[model samples]
Target: MTWETGGKSEEPDGAGRRDPAPPPVGGILWSVAGDIRVLLTLPSALTMQVAHPAVGAGVDTYSVFRTDPWGRGERSLRSAQLWVYGGEEAAEEGRRLRRLHRTIQGTDTRGRPYHALMPANYAWVHATGFPVFRHASAYLQRRPYTPAEERQLYAEWLRVGRILGIHDRDMPQTLEEFWPYYRRMLAEELELTAVADELTSVDRPVPPPDRGPLALRLPLRLLWPVLFPPIARFRRFATIGLMPPDAREAIGLPWTDAQERRLRALGRVVRVVVPLLPERLRYLPLARRARARARRPG
Candidate 1:
């Protein structure tokens, strides 16, 4: 009736299976970091939706439910209500979604429809399902929620059920529904990015002279070493099969030209500087040198 790991033990369920350990804080941190990366790289319009207050609130509510479903009590009900009204921002978001939907509805270029561009809008049901189940399991295991939180969580669950066209009586009692939702959400994010890019291109024009200071544009020189390596690795990992042999003749990884130039510049700098430094100072000094080079005027 007990499960043990790293000398820690907890009671097992009646079925005699031990409970899985809680996910490490590191994984949660990494997940947030990945979300940030995706947000930054995505198109402004798509990123705006993810950053919306309502969406953020939903994600927070979802995370809390996943982490401690029973603990949500009254807070869970509040979250559900918030979601129902789409928070204070729903009207604007609804307008944007409608406009985006219209923009993309029949505009598929390669046999894929415009609706494909707003994938995330249609993925709401899937996006909310997994955390609900995951947290429900945790709630059963830990019994940490006040009665109020449990009620609220259930309220939110009921609302989600309605939105997704799930019958309260027929809602999934297990985790089988979670995976499909996650996949659909990811696919929607990809499609949304493509659509956003198209919108940006169509709207491009000269900026006003008094448009004022840029926000979030750190000097690329200062950011290069700190930002480029991980970005390069991520690009490589994400694009393993991005191009077919035939397509490579006409198109390639979007970064092929820029990446080649940066890598060559990096290599040239490394070749000239590495041997000049003392062996003891090489690794540490190399970073400083890279930073310095990044700051230099072209």
Candidate 2:
């Protein structure tokens, strides 16, 4: 959440001049469960300036340093190296690794200093681990990070990036580029729960038909109705402020002067529709059924 960039300098001629900060150099950091992954991007030169001195000095200084995944001790360098190198190929691998790392680490959408936990937990569940079960359990428990711990993790990310030949000037932009991949990974993980529910349902047993016509047709048919109403609603609400300005801006869908008028018109229609629809029917029945079945005892 705390994005830093290079510092600016004062100008002469009475028109205040400023210098833009350098881009982030790639770096590595530790997860809450104490695994090292690259940071890939950082905000300010000052931030990295503060963190640069401690790379590889010892486990205590490194963020990803932990004796074991859940062990309450400093991590060994071997553990950090293992986490960095696992199943990775070496060509521009640091950038790819950092992108994957951020997707799992989750960002502070609200611009907070620390990363969020839920997404990290989701990532840990899917990623193969070194000390496997111990790391997984730490994620499940949602442990909080101490101030020292946060700084340490940040430092480790920077260190790893340096080792991999990632330069400081290229760090921030590199991380931004990698953001999309993280989002895709999170979306894919969410889709898995839906798949699991469908497979386990007794009433909705899998069809024995070969993967042919029925397979192609059923999903399309099922999705068509589900999408139509929402699309209609979104179009109707398009002129209204269906989403907050900041949310739209964060996702790069900033409103224009024309969009403001459209949003207002859409809002008006959505307000009218809300009261007309039954509460139970507001959500799609398919989604509701899935939720209901998920909660049922085995």
Give lDDT for model 1: 0.32
Worst 10 residues of 2 by lDDT: 37-46
RMSD of each: 20.3, 22.8
**lDDT, candidate 2, 1-298, per-residue tens:** 1111111223222124222221122221222222211111111111111211111111122222122321221112223333334222222332333333332232222223332113333222222121121222222222334546434444444344443334444332243433454344333322212222221222332222223367666675567556545544443333112323322232233357776676455435544664466535543333233335545898
Residue 182, candidate 1: Cα error in Å is: 6.8
Q: Candidate 2: lDDT of 54?
A: 16
TM-scores of the models, in the order given: 0.27, 0.22
Question: Which prediction has the highest lDDT against the true structure?
Answer: 1
